[model samples]
Target: MLSAGSLATLFENTIGPAFDDAHEYGYRGEFHGSNAVMRMVLDEQKQPDVIVSADAELLRTRLPEDIAPWDVVFGSNALVIAYGPDTAVGERLEGEEPWFEVLSEADAEIARSDPDLDPLGYRALQLFDLAEQYYDRDGLAPALTENLVIDPQEAHILARVEAQERAAAIVYKNMAVDHGLPYVELPEKLDFSNPEHADYYAQATYTTEDGTTVEGAPVLYNATVPSTAPNPEAGRAFLKFLLSNPEMLTENGLVVTDAFPRPHGPVPEEIVP
Candidate 1:
């Protein structure tokens, strides 16, 4: 499966087994950067039956119309700081104080994914930029990024935290929940989980070296079938199975929509808005 790195934990335990039983095909999901997946499929000619993204709009923005004319907006997730093991710092990191204040402590060692390659990394910058304005701390955004240990993807950041190679990492809340890792929650205002705050979230932006501007938006997970899918029928069937299991999706740390969203192009009969 070509899925986002944030879903690494969920697919490990839930999707693979369910897919295997339903389609009698052994499947293992790969954890890659969401934006990186787009580059791989577009530039490197990588092909996968299913492609999942952290941003719903990316399907239209990054993929050609024929490649992925439609995509399903399946779930919502938000950012959190996943700290290393059971240190006092880790414990205090868990909603103990204003999250920004705690993170600003002298002892905090923050890690972030590479922004250009991964949405998480880009979103992390967005979070900090929003935090700068919301908290009214001048230069806070750049300060937070300063001295951060940058990894290629979210999973790499998680790996560093799990190995105690880093003190903390900014990652998706569901990722820390699924992995049973210690974490600190950010406020809903700062957390890009609610679509209601889309306008407010858009106030924050990050620009890449090439002058590409990445704006902030709610954290939404989208999935699509590539036109070049090896098994189009199986892909649709699998998508049906996933959308049908709203309860299981929640149990695995996703805030799934009550109904499958109507998409733009041909979709499985099972998908319903």
Candidate 2:
């Protein structure tokens, strides 16, 4: 199985066990960013039985048509500013303080995943671009970009923040909560949580290092069974388990969906309560 790094804990602790309960065997999930995991499948010729991604459109980007016709949205997340204890900048990044300004402040260490490698990376950059419009801060995007030290994936950024190597970083809200990291609760305008802001957020977009256009949208977690999966039945069973046991997700700080975001082509009947 391949899963997004952010969902590593959930899959290992909850989803995998549930799968084993029904399948008679346990599988070790290879966790990586959505992009990296897909890259391995396509370039490295790795064939994971199941695939999950932080981006709801995981099946996009030229995934083999037979591998996955559509991706299903299973969870949602909000972006927030997470702070490590050792960071020098304190309450200024706290309540009602314009986070854009603090991010622009020199000496504020910002580590983010690489836009070309991790969806979170591009999302973080898009947040900066959105901040430019939301706060009308003309140079906010460039300033924040200048401060970022890119990691290969979101997990790496989390590791550095956990180690207190950086003061603050743009990360999923659940990540901050799960790690017990105090965070700046970003407004819906910035958090990428409210679907109502979808169009507003879309106003901001970022071109990845490879020049791929990534538009701003709410954070969503989606999963799918690859057409190349060795056991398509097992993949379907796993999705059934997760959609049925959403508590397995909510308990971990991820917001479970009441229903599939939308009918994504074909899905198992068991998945739709």
Candidate 3:
């Protein structure tokens, strides 16, 4: 299986073992940024039984029709400012002060993943722009951008925050929860959590240094079995189990609200509940 780095813990520690127990079959997973993994599949010809992506649109648009023609949107996540408790920003985050105000006034360095490599990275940039609009503050996004340190992986960004090597990082809420790090939740409008706010989210756009433009949208997780999967039967079985049990995602600190198991393209009917 190939998966987004954000899902490392859930897949490695829980889901993989649980599926093995339930169905008498186990699988190995290689986790990284969704785009990077997609590149591996396309460029390096590394085929996995299943491919799970953090960005729904990336799966829908980037992975060609001949490769992974169908995908199911199964889970969602929100962004948060995860910090080390010992840091100054962390101290204020625990207080009654508004999160955006604290972030705007803080002088500490902030870490983020590379927008070109990871969805979380681009989503962080989008969140900043949304925060600017939501807070009605001009130049807020630029102010936040002024102190960023771009790490190429979300795992590394969250690791830096946890180790206090950096004060904080904008990361997926599950990453903070998985690492047991302190975090302040941003507003749903800024965090890309509320699907009803899709139009508002679309107003925020981020252009990567490499020139790819990502428009803001709800943070959704997508999964599919590629056409050339080495173990297609196993892939289909696992996906069926996943769609049948949405509670596994909800238990892992993701937002698996009513808008889940939304199948796209020519998904196999047995896997689409």
Model 3 vs truth, CA RMSD: 1.6
Per-candidate Cα lDDT values, in order, are 0.77, 0.76, 0.84
Candidate 1 vs candidate 2: the lDDT winner is 1
Candidate 1 ranges beyond 4 A from true positions: 209-211, 259-262, 270-273
For candidate 1, write residues 59-175 as lDDT tens digits: 568888888987888888888888875654576665376667666653656888888777788888899889999989998877777746788767657777777777788988888
- Candidate with the larger lDDT of 1 and 3: 3
Give model 3's TM-score versus the native structure: 0.94
lDDT of model 3 at position 46: 84
Residue-level lDDT tens digits of model 2 in 92-151? 664446777777884867877777776787888888888888877688789888988877
Candidate 2 minimal-lDDT segment of 10 residues = 87-96
Model 1 RMSD to the real structure? 2.1
Error of 2 at 96 (Å): 5.4
lDDT of 3 by residue, 1-273 (tens): 888889998888778888988996686888888777777888856889999999998877778899988999998999988888898888988885787777777898888887877788888888888888788899998888877788777655688777788888988998888889978887888888878889999998877555767788888999999999978989999989888887877787887867788889999988877
Q: lDDT (0-100) at residue 35 of candidate 1? A: 79
Top TM-score prediction, candidate number: 3
TM-score of 1: 0.91
